[model samples]
Target: MNISDQLSITAKGNPSKTAYIFQGEKTSYMELEGAVTKFASSLKELGYEKGDHIALVSGNSPYYVIGLYGALRLGLTVIPINPIYTVEEMRYILKNGDVKGVITMDLFMDKFVALASDFPEIHHYIVGDTGADVSHAQKLLNDKMKSFTGLMRTAELSLERPTIDDEDVAIILYTSGTTGKPKGAMLTHKNVYSNAKDVADYLKYSPEDKVIATLPMFHVFCFTVALNAPLMNGGTVLILPRFSPEDVFKVAKDEKATVFAGVPTMYNYLLQGGEAHKTDFESIRLCISGGASMPVALLKQFEQAFQVIVSEGYGLSEASPVTCFNPLDRPRKAGSIGQNIWNVENKVVDELGDEVPVGEVGELVVRGPNVMKGYYKLPEETAVSLRDGWLYTGDMAKVDEEGYFYIVDRKKDMILVGGYNVYPREVEEVLYQHPNVTEVAVVGAPDPNLGEAVQAFVVVNDTITEDQLLDYCREHLAKYKLPTVIEFLDELPKNTTGKILRKNLRDRVTQ
Candidate 1:
C-alpha cells in the first residue's frame, strides 16, 4: 500500500492518538488525516490532477507535513526543496522537474513573485501562513496566488481518490551532487513505503515510541526514519523546528522521547555540553546516527556520557535513504553500519561488478524494493548508477565475516598520493582519536612533488599545535598517508544536513 493508505489505516485504528507534536501543539491522527483530505481536495478543485509535480519548500513545520501527505494523497509527485537554497538552485529543480505548482511559506512569497514571470507554466502558488503580511506579494501574484490556510479551511473533503499503483512515482528527491547540477531521484510508492515499514520494524517502533524529528525533513534520512517510520507504526512524532542542543534536550525530557536521530556533527555538539544534561535523555532508549560517518571516538564518547545506544547506519537518497542500521538485539559495533536490514541486500563489489572478498574495500551496491526506479529525465546518468537491477552506490565500503558493513569513504573523495590509494576517512579517524579534537575532515591538496598531498581541517576544543597533531598522527598513520598541512577552523563547512562539505574544502585548497 501507498504511504497515504497506510496512514489512513493507522488513523482508523487510533483516531485520537497524537500523530505529531510541533511547537507545543498536538495534532491528533483524525485531525491530521482530515487536513490532508481537505488540502488534496482543494488541489483537485484547482485543476491539479494525478501525476502533477509540486514543489514543497519550507522548514520543519506542521504545514510541511500536511503539504507532503496532501499531495501524495492525490497521487501527485512532491519535490521537497531546502528552504535556505538560493534562487538559482531552487529554479533549477522547478524548471527541470517540470513542476506545475508550489507550496511554500509566506515568508518566501517575494521569491515566487520574482520567478512568476519566468515560470508561467506554474499555475498555483499556495503559500502557508507564517504570520508574515504578504499583501504586496499577493497583489503581484494576483489570480495565481492561493492561501494555504484558506484552501484547507474552505475546501470540502469529498474529492475522489485516484488509483495509485505501487510503481507510480511519489517523490522526486534531488541528490546534492558535488560536481554539476543535482540529479532528481524518482522514488516509487513501493520504494518509499517499503523502506519506512522495514525501518519501523527493524527499530522496533510501536504506538508508545515517540521519535524526535530535529533533522531537516527535506532530506531523505529524516523523512523516512524520523517522520514516516513513526507514523507508519502509529507512533507519536515530536517535531522540533530546528536542531539545537538545548531545544532537543528540553523536548526529550519533557515529552519522554524514546528515539532520537541525527548526524555525526550533531552528536559532537551534544557531547560538548552533554554531561550536564545526562538526565535529560534518560527516557531516550535509542540514538541513530547517519548523513555522515560517525567518528568512532565521538560515538563512544556520546554513548558513555548520555548512557544511550547510538546506532550508525548507511543510505543514499536513491534508496529511500535507509538500507542498513546497527542491530539493536546484538552487541552494537562502533564503526560498522551493521548488517543489511529486512529485504534489502548490500554487497561490496569491485570495479567489474564482482563481489570482493571479506575485509577488502570496494564500491557498495544495493538491491531491494527501496531503490528508486531511476533518475528523473537523466537516462544516461541513471544507467550508469542503476544496472542489472542493482543500485551501484558510489560509497567505498567493506564487510566483515559477521556480515556487518563499514563505510570507508566516498569513492570520489578518495585521494591518490604518488599512485598509492589514500582514503581520507582513514586519516580522519586517527585525528578524531585525540582528546582535544572535536571534529576533523581530510582532503587532497594540489602538490607538484607527490602529485597530491593530504591536507587536514580540524576543529578543536583546546589548544593543539600542528606539530603536536602531526607527531600524534605519525604513530598511527603511514608516512605516505600523513597530512602535510593542517588548518584549524571554528567549524567545518557543511551542507544543510550537517555532512562535512569535503568538496568545499578541496576548493579552498585549489584557491
Candidate 2:
C-alpha cells in the first residue's frame, strides 16, 4: 500500500481529530487532508506528475507536512532538504536528483534565485511565506517563484491518487557524508510505511497520544517517528518551529503530550535548563532517543529528572531510518539499542560475513523490508552497500547473550593506539559519567610515537580543570583508552539533526 493512503485512512476514520498543532494553531485531520488534496492537484495542474522529483526545504512547520504528504499523494519522489543548506550543498543534491521543482520557505529564495540559471532542470518554485517578512527579496524572485498559498487557493479540492507500486521510490534521503560526497538513499513506499507502522506498534501509540515534534522534519529519524508514526495512528503532533526549551515545555504541559522524540543533545539541554526541573513532565509517558547514541549516564539522568521512560533506538538512512529500539515491555537496558524490531533481522558479522560470537564486537548488518531499494543513480555504490539481501551498516557493535545490541563505534572511527584498538564510545561513556561534564566527544589524533592518540573535547557545567577530568578518565579507563588531551568547548558541533560531527573534530588538526 502507498504511504499516503495512511493519512487518507486516518482522516476518514476520524475527520475531526486534531492532526497537528503548530505554534498555537490547531489543524483537524479533515482540514489537513483537504489541504494535501488541493496541493497535489496544484502540482498536477502545473504539469508535474507521478515519478517526478520534488524537493521540500523547510524547518518544522505545517507547510512542510502538507507539501510532503501532498507530493506523496501524487506519487512524486519527495526530496527533503535541510533548510540551512549552503548554495553549493543545495546545488549538488538538486543536480544529482534532477529535481523538477522545489517547495521552500521564503528564507531561502535568494539561494534559489542565484542558482536558477545554473540548474535549468527545476521547472517550478513554490515558496512558503512562513509568517516572515520576506517582501524585500520578492522582487528578485518574482520571475519564477510561485506563492504556496496562492496555488492552494487557485486549485480544486479533489485529487486522483496515483497508482503506486509498493517498491516505488518515495523519498531520496542524502547521507550526511562524513567521509565523501553524500549518496541519496532511495527509500520505497513500503520501506517508510513498514518502519512507521512497526515503530508505532512497538511504542503502543494510541489516538489519545500527543507527540512532541521538536526535531527537524528533513531528518529521517523525526520524519518517521515524530511525523509519520503519530499521524498514521491518528494521534496529534505538537510541532515547534525551532527547538526552544521554553516552547517545548509549554506545549508538553499545555497539550498533555504523551510521546516526545528527540536527540541526545536536546535532552542534555533540557536537563541543564531551569524549566525541566520545575515543569511537570508527568504527562510525557514515553520518550524516544536516536540520531546519536544517548550517553547511558545522560539517559539515566534524564529519566530520573523527568520521571519518564526513555527508549534508545538505532538506525541509518538506508534502513528506512530504524532497525532496533529498546522494547517497552522488556527490561530497558542502559545504552542498548535493544533487539531488532518486528520484521527485521540483525546480526554482528566479521569481515568474512560470518556471525560473530556473542559479546565480540563486529560490523552490524541487517536484512528487512525496511531497507532502501538502493542508492539513487549510483549502482556501484548501491552494489557495495546492499549485498545478498543484507545491508552492511558500518557500525561496530556487539550483541549480548540477552539479544540486546550495543554500538561500539563507527568502523572508520576506531582508533589504533600503537597495536591496541580503542573504541571512542567506550571513552565517551566514561566521560559522561562525570557529574560536571555536560557533553563530550572523543576522537583520535595523530602522534609522533603512536599511530593515533585518543583526544577528547568536553563541555562542562561547573568548575573542573583539564587535569582533573583526565585523572577521572584514568581511574575508569585503561592507559591506552584514556584521553591524552582534553579540550573544553561551550558545545560540540552538530548537524541540523543534532548528530555530533566527529569528522569536523578530526579536520581541526589536519586543516
Top candidate (TM-score): 1
* lDDT: worst 10-residue window of model 2: 273-282
Name model 2 segments beyond 4 Å from true.
131-143, 274-278
The lDDT of each candidate is 0.94, 0.90
TM-score, predicted candidate 1 vs. hidden true structure: 0.99
Instruction: Report lDDT (Cα) of residue 376, candidate 2.
Output: 93
Give lDDT tens digits, candidate 2, residues 268-355: 8888884444455779989899998899999998888887889999999999889999999977999999999999989999999999
**Local lDDT at 316 for model 2:** 94
lDDT of 1 at 328: 95
Clash pairs for candidate 1: none
lDDT of 2: 0.90
Question: On a 0 to 100 scale, what is the lDDT of residue 200 in model 2?
Answer: 85
